[model samples]
Target chain A: MPPPLKAVLADDEKSLCVHLKNLLQQAWPELQICAEARNGVEALEMIEKHHPDIAFLDIKMPGMSGMEVARRAADMCRIVFITAYDQFAVQAFENEAVDYLLKPVEPERLARTIQRLKERFEKRDLDPAPIQAVLKSLQGRLAAAAPPPYLKWIKVPDRQSLRLIAVEEICCFQAQDKYTVVQTEREEFLIRKPIKELVDELDPQTFWQIHRSTIVNAAWIDKISTSLTGSYVLTLKRRPGTFTVSRGYRDRFKSM
Target chain B: MMKTGNKLQTPCDSVRQKDFKPMSPTLRQHRKGLSWKDLGLTALFSTIIAALLTYVFQDESFWVYLIISQGIGLSICTLCRYSLALFNPQTSWGIVAVVATASIFGGMLGGTVGAWLSGIEMPIFLSKKIYTLRVLIMSLLFGSVIAYYFFSRERLSEIRGLLQEERIQRLTSEKHAVQSQLKMLQAQIEPHFLFNTLSNILSLLDSDAARGKTMLRDLTRYLRASLAESRSQWSTLGSEMELVGAYLNIFKIRMDERLQVHIEMDEALKEIPFSPMLIQPLVENAVIHGLDATIEGGTIHIRAEQENGLLRITVADTGQGIASVPSPGLGLANIRERLQALYGGRGRLIITENQPRGVKAVIEVPYATAP
Candidate 1:
């Protein structure tokens, strides 16, 4: 048999990297793991130095993105992308025509991708047209779509199931202990997400920046009224309705 | 109204004018002033005391009878009224005390003759010691009753006023808090959005210049929408979806083929109003933490449905699942807090391991109509 296909694995997650390496060794004992890289730049360097026949690339890395590395390494070796993203990037992958594996790297999927890579190597015809089209479509979608920064709903753990909460139904989001709470019209649920991350994605129009630790739904606002104690308080249109906006956020109501 | 006139005409009014003292004290003192009922009760008690004294002194000289009768009646009546004013400041007790004092004194004094004629000595018939004790006790009891009646009536009115004031204060504070918080939450959404979008734009500038131009236009639309309602707290679901679509596109550029997104929403719920930016963060988390960490790209499915009286939205990814590092990223946490602030106890977010693998984030909120 032609000398076992030389390969390299690149990923930031140590456990996953090891798992994939083991799986590869099991599938093709002769396949040599020439080098391992933890990031895109390192992966690129290793590919350049070792000239591996095949490379498994993780899309996101600290130094350089997997795509950036792939773009640079496109002519040098066959690339198989491994990632956890969705269809929005499918076009980009398709444009590359590079074999890709979804995360949790199923053995069967890995085997198929490897088989395809080997077949392409033998044929010596790695067409970049499909990849180019996919990339174009992805870019088109990104350009045309409007980004909603806010989260409209969240899925929470329930009894053996999950609960979906509409963001509008929420009155306030409060950080408590280690978890953030989603307070709504009927109940409250605890979730393990950071406040900063939520702030990044929420829509600016409906969610108000009340304090460092709190975000309020603007629709729930009844009015801005001064407390007898000379502080600002928020009144909700709902029952048992009142929340204090910290002094730091007082300036936020200038327009209101 | 009549009592108020007397207060305004009083010498204290002149003092108030000169001092420019707060009106609260004067108003309170005025409220404590005696009314018609108090005066009537005082007069009745005085008369009964006078009559009793006169009856007791019937065998004594007229001068003695007159002196004792006038002295006791006047002294007791004046003292009872002053006591009513001082002790029962709340008014209800004052009324009860005044009325009770008058009734007891009048009944005892008026019935003395009947007891004397029933074969009993004038002093022994009413039992001088017992009569005196009874008079004192009855006078006190009646005085308290009078004071209580007046006190209760005044107290009820005062309580009503206080309740009204409290209600206003409560409403005012609540309004302010809501406004401030709304502003804060609104403020928090834009910066991160701009940052992420700008990053997307940067990425697109290199690979596809035409797409970058289009993305810039979309960004402008998003910015316009965000600025259009710097003060609005709610938006149509359709508009929010449009915003999410834009955000997803930006991610699509950064993530390239490693990310797949699917949005499944009920057509009927599309018109419903929801918190803006409510769905975008979950999708972001799926891309950044869930899918970004994996070597191979995965699918992010966002599904919205109306079940029971609630709206259920799910963001699921076939990614690396929760990080093995035992800590979650910040995006999911922030989304949860925003939900809580908007819904209080009504909203919920659930996170679980998706079928086969990956993570699923679900949010549920009561269906609310636009105000």
Candidate 2:
């Protein structure tokens, strides 16, 4: 028998994730599923923790996208992307000859993917360079297609009137008590906008999401301190209190 | 009018020429009756030809020979028109042969009969060979010249008819080009939405047959609505709403609980000639750009009303509040262009921020009936 293998799967939809897990189990009973994640962020943590031989990722998720995750963890394992239907993503994958499964994954197509994965995995084809080129091209294509002007200003209630706060002035955003708390130098005001949407609206270069409920401005970071329990806590320049980087977000602070 | 003749002509043969102008068939096999007006035209042309011949030959009785020669000319014309099925006339020489044949037949017949009639005395031309030969040669020259004139007149008219048909064909093609350009302005389908919906249906087909069937039905309706009306530039408000309704139903099933919709339309405005594709694109914009951008999703409200001879439509949404980057065009420009193409400066589409959040697009046009 081939050496035992482990794989982790990630998808935002709970039903779809379960469906894929079931399909994978049926296809290869001996292969073990070490972990499962509901989004791109958790998928990275699971891959890091389990050191799996393969990762099955969904291309779209709320906070972090699968391509972004693949860019970060490409050297760790072979990736088989799951996408409902994305023109640029599919085109890039086709160009790089990468493995991708269309949604409602047919048994026949999945079998083909399995055969390819087993062959490549045995050949020790864990090179991250070519896959990185595909992701870069895909990113360029998506940017050229949308070039979406990211959210620049957010409004929060200020006394009797509404105020438009420049996104740069804001230090952090956290979801609390069914409302989002927008943090600035002189303000910690509440707004109805949720963190789920802020992940998509804010530019990733300037804003880094460190927790499910929190996002911090990269320029406002004061320092990263390690705790005895082996957790990372982020200290900001303007903000008074520190925020604990969650288990899934520790990779952002790993280099530091 | 078909009774008068000279005494030398046998009674039966002269009667045949006078009364039996048989109907003839054209090249296409359609029968043409020999009408009195046709005969009158033949008589008029014969008189003119005879008058010219009289001047040249100095013979008073040449008119009778000209009239008699008309029969031979008419028969030959019918044969030429009908025999095209047997003969190829695309070559220039073939049709000019019609003039040649008519000239030869006209000269020989006119010389034989004209010599007999112009020689009104008791066989004087038979006694003088030079006189008979002179009259025969002169008649041949004059008959050919006269027949060639009529043949050219007929050819000129045929060329004019051909040119007229070519002009009509050019106009029709120009109209077709204009029509196709408008259709190009119609909605271009987004491949992402199409494939995603198809994938969703594939997934649901096994798990929930009933819901899958419902989605299939809605998709069929949506396709029928969109594809059928695309050929036309104007549609009834009621039918356009039906298209929007089918479109919303498909999304409602796919998005499930993430989407909410509210539509309000008056019954009387349904039959008015509204611009096609204006509302559906706006609704699609609201769903894809306004609601789908946010995780929690939101509601799309479509309202149409007719007030004071004006039809007004609004599609509003409560999603990202237009504060987010607008979708690629979102069919906003298309909607505006179609309205302008239809109404000149009288129609308008306006975009504004929805109450507390989202985007609201409105259209106003005169409630004109079908023109």
Candidate 3:
């Protein structure tokens, strides 16, 4: 008979690790758990030491993520990601044909994963192409999972009292030397965050950077016309004056 | 002289005049009615028209012609403004129709008023046997051209405005739908507890039925309470505490002596309105992240209090220090989102290293009675 398969399990939850081991023992009695790790950093060390046939990993762990571990160790062993995210991002993993065990892994599902692993092992197949492709796609989706929620309201000093202005009400943000000016239809206020930071935090679809120092709300834009000087000017619906679209940002108004 | 057509006053002038008397003295300067501006402009135009007519006809009594011109100009300007300001003609065709009709009637009324004020009955002007007939025909043509030109210009901008307004409405609704969907997903009682807890209970059911039964009961209660709160997005601090009790009970059963939980809250402050499932996630973080990592396990303290007009909830675990604040998870992200959605700038979550050992998460929200 073929030698029993050796596997490593890595998860932050100690109770979960114990439960998973018990289930794995029941489902695959011949399987050997050579090492157990409670986080990603230890998982890598254990994988290198044991060189197990398979690695089960929790996607989120303390020092490093499972994705990072898989990237470093996919050549050494097959990877099965254990994830707690059932949000929109899990679909990416499923679409890429990578195996994943959802949090509170069910025995029935774990059995299916073991069955697949056994088939691959019996054939002596160690091709990592599919796994690598899945990892690449997953990297993109994981990066997209949470962009810290945008600024909802900004507190600015009004003439007498601080006025809380809704971010949506802002027509544009113009950068000064040290601070940025938040302009609405009626008045402007100074804020500490730079234009660069605002560009990263604001939803790109709603706000567009038309100049090096100005970010305008797309909804308030009234018209975009080429000036006699051959530069583009953006007029706003409620606010006076126009913003010039610099040569670098001319591509933004190409369709208009 | 025709530039005045673009600067014609609106029907709001009449409405503003009626309500002008009742406004507070302070607002009168900023919110002035347009009647004065229109009146002054009309008088100026009439004087110009009178001078032009006298220079052309060299009439014996220039004063009489000037008075007549003033009456006619005032009537025509007021009539045109009233007709044009009632409703925004959305379509190009509708704008044209309204402008044409208003122009013709305004010219006819002005001619009649002009003749009456000049001491000549309008019947002579309309009799079709005088040179005044030619002048009337000329006025009608000029008025129609000017009104149509002005309104067509206005229509171009109006169409653009409507399209933009429609787009804004559509985008706003789409944004609302997306936000509500995110809220639902964030507030959902996650199934992470389901399969694992059930599996654990399954193992215990055969060996330790009493413990398994207690765990099952607590899990069911926690799920039920969470599901109920998720539907409404809120609950009283008292009920939320009951939910937390059920939750910690399940974990306690799972870990046995490895987990210790201490919950404290004043009875008087229990009825204060609070967001549900918020503190429980932090408590779960304490147990799973802080205590689960330590070999000996440790205590998790859940405390809620009213301090300085704010509701403060703290989850402190005596296991590890801030070294193991698990990478950003959905639970932490959702907690931040729910707080922001509920309280704007007033709600805050603070994480700090507790003295002696472990991590503390403090959540403060505006204190208020149940809605």
iRMS of candidate 1, Å: 15.0
Docking class of 1: incorrect
Looking at candidate 2 chain B, the ten consecutive residues that score lowest on lDDT are B21-30
The CAPRI-style docking tier of model 2 reads incorrect
How high is each candidate's TM-score? 0.40, 0.50, 0.54
In the range B62-145, model 3's lDDT, one tens digit per residue, is 665566566655665566566545533433455456556655566567656766777776666577454254335435544554
Candidate 2's TM-score on the B chain: 0.50
Worst 10 residues of 3 chain B by lDDT: B23-32
Q: Per-residue lDDT of A7-90 in model 2, one digit per residue for the tens?
A: 999876554565677778889877799888876778899999998988999887544678888988899888889998787788
Distance (Å) between predicted and true CA of B156, model 2?
40
What is the TM-score of chain A, computed separately for every candidate?
0.52, 0.59, 0.61
Which stretches of model 1 miss by more than 4 angstroms?
Answer: A1-158, A162-256, B1-129, B132-196, B275-299, B315-371
Candidate 1 residue B297 Cα shift, in angstroms, is: 7.9
Off by over 4 Å in 3: A1-3, A81-119, A145-256, B1-67, B70-186, B192-215, B230-234, B245-264, B275-303, B308-371
The candidate that achieves the highest DockQ relative to the unseen native structure: 3
State the lDDT of candidate 1 residue by residue for B266-331, as single tens digits.
Answer: 778888978766676667667666786665668888888888888888889898755342232334
True contacts kept of each: 0.03, 0.12, 0.04
Q: Please give the clash total of every predicted structure, in order.
A: 152, 1, 0
List, residue by residue over A1-256, the lDDT tens digit for candidate 3: 8778899999765666777788899999999999898778899999999989999998766566788899899999988888765554367567766778876677899999889888888898778877788778767665664334666455676554444455566899999999999997656889898999999888788799988899998877766655445577777864678788999988867764
Interface RMSD score of each model: 15.0, 29.6, 13.5
